[model samples]
Target: MKLLLTSAGIMNKSIHDTLVDMLDKPIGESSALCIPTAMYGHPWVGPGVQAWEFIKGDARNPMVNLGWKSVGVLELTALPSINKDRWVSLVQETDVLLVAGGDPLYLCYWMQQSGLADLLPSLRSVYVGMSAGSMVMAPHIGEYFVGWNPPNDSDETLNLVDFAMFPHVDHEMLPHNTMAHAEKWAADIQGPAYAIDDETAIKVIDGAVEVISEGNWKLFSS
Candidate 1:
């Protein structure tokens, strides 16, 4: 699968160009399925509201400027109550999967329940994971410790990728995600860890992994 996992979506022209190249088609002919289910876990709160607004806006200029013709949201939580086959079809037809950041476990639950996990390996779409969305692709979620909620009881994640990703590290806007926190989080993990800021990301195409950054990031081994 082709994945462009970011702390924040499309931070610069270089990343945008890379994504467009990965798509291998004019963005105008493509469709992006934006998943906002992760943000729902934090309803009414400041961070939640911010994520919800991101979904509502769909990173308007970032996506529009890239030339994606159809950018729409597909709430995975609501799929079980509807026609899943059609939903799956839509997922398959999408050229990109724009996943927003929030609760990693909550996002993983819906993904497994909706059967997206099973289908992800074969998906032709470019997977763009923002923050928690990127975290869910790891073997497990680490000490994300953002808003001081109860720790995720289950550490298991989708395991689509091999390493734990610590996103928003040293992020200017999110003072809560400090380099110190990232260091502590990685120290406790058992495998390779990546601390990525908003301007950086971890991109995996097929079996190859590379840090795609316009700003800064660090990879740690345990």
Candidate 2:
């Protein structure tokens, strides 16, 4: 599987180039499915549309800037109520799957219920995960306290990758995401953890992991 897990999506030219290189195909010829289900975790935060617009402005444009022919938002939660077969077909057709950030636990719940997690491993598309999206790929996600409830023992994530990921590290705008908070979170993790800022990405191809960053990031181990 090919994955580009980022703290805040593609943040620079080099990161865009890396994604393009991985695509192999000309960017204009491909399509992308941008899942924003995670943002729904806190629907009451400001206007829901504002968060959607923000994700689009910050994250979606990068894909378009790189030349993806068409990129559309597909909320995984709406799948079960609609014609899921069509959604599955869309997933199959997309060249890349971009999962946006919000709450990891919220995203995991829908992923599990929608059966998206089960199908992710077999997909040929490149997976570009932002924040919460990146975290769900780990064996376990803990020390994650957002507006929603905390993850309990029964809240198993899709263990797509081995290590847990903590995004938005030391970001001034994010009050809860400070270096001190990350240190405490990492210390409590049962396995390895990675703390990354907006301009960083953790790329995983097959089984090899590479950190690509234009900002700061660090690895924490028990």
Candidate 3:
């Protein structure tokens, strides 16, 4: 399976060109299963809400514009009570799986509870993860707190990829306090990790990873 773990949208022309080349298929021919599983935090709630509205509004627009025929947007917010069979079916049938940004911890918890953690690695579809989506696919979750009534515990991750990924790297949208928090989390880990700036992505193919972008990519390994 081809995986694109990006920090944010495909804002870079070079990255977009590479992504288009890697897929090797017209955008309209591919279908996507969008799992907005990571947007469980306040920082993403508003933007997620707005983006979701666009996805659902004219399915034809995003789909056609992006070179896909269908887009399945799953409502993963109601976690631990999700339908496993249905979720699995969506993941199984899609040409690509697009995971949006949010809180990594929340995304991990839901994926575990929903049994998706066990099923993703074996899937043959393209896995596209952004921000928190990228974080949950790592060995551990990055520290990005959501200011909720009571902060949720940092959950165990899917471990599909060996290293932890920090998205929105060097982006002005990322808060200063959040950066310090993430750094502490990175320091606590005993293995390699990566921090990807907005529009940059890391693609893992045949067990080898290549950084794809027009900007800088950072890595930390002990």
TM-score of 3: 0.80
lDDT of each: 0.78, 0.79, 0.66
Clashes of each: 0, 0, 4
Tell me the tens digit of each residue's lDDT in model 2 across 1-222: 699998887888767777887888777888888887887785553237746664465544254334578887777887778877778878877899888777787888889778788889988899998888898898777746444564553445778888888898878778888877888988978878899998889999987889999998889998
Better of 2 and 3 by lDDT: 2
Cα error, candidate 1, residue 25 (Å): 1.2
Pairwise lDDT winner, candidates 1 and 3: 1
Error of 2 at 166 (Å): 1.0
* lDDT for each residue of candidate 3 in 31-100, tens digit (9 for 90 to 100): 8877765665546454445456534532321221365678777656653576666567777777877776
Candidate 2, which segments miss by more than 4 Å at Cα? 43-47, 54-56, 59-66, 150-155
Scored by lDDT, model 2 comes in at 0.79
The C-alpha RMSD of each candidate to the native structure, in angstroms, is 2.7, 2.5, 4.0
Supply candidate 1's per-residue lDDT for 161.
Answer: 91
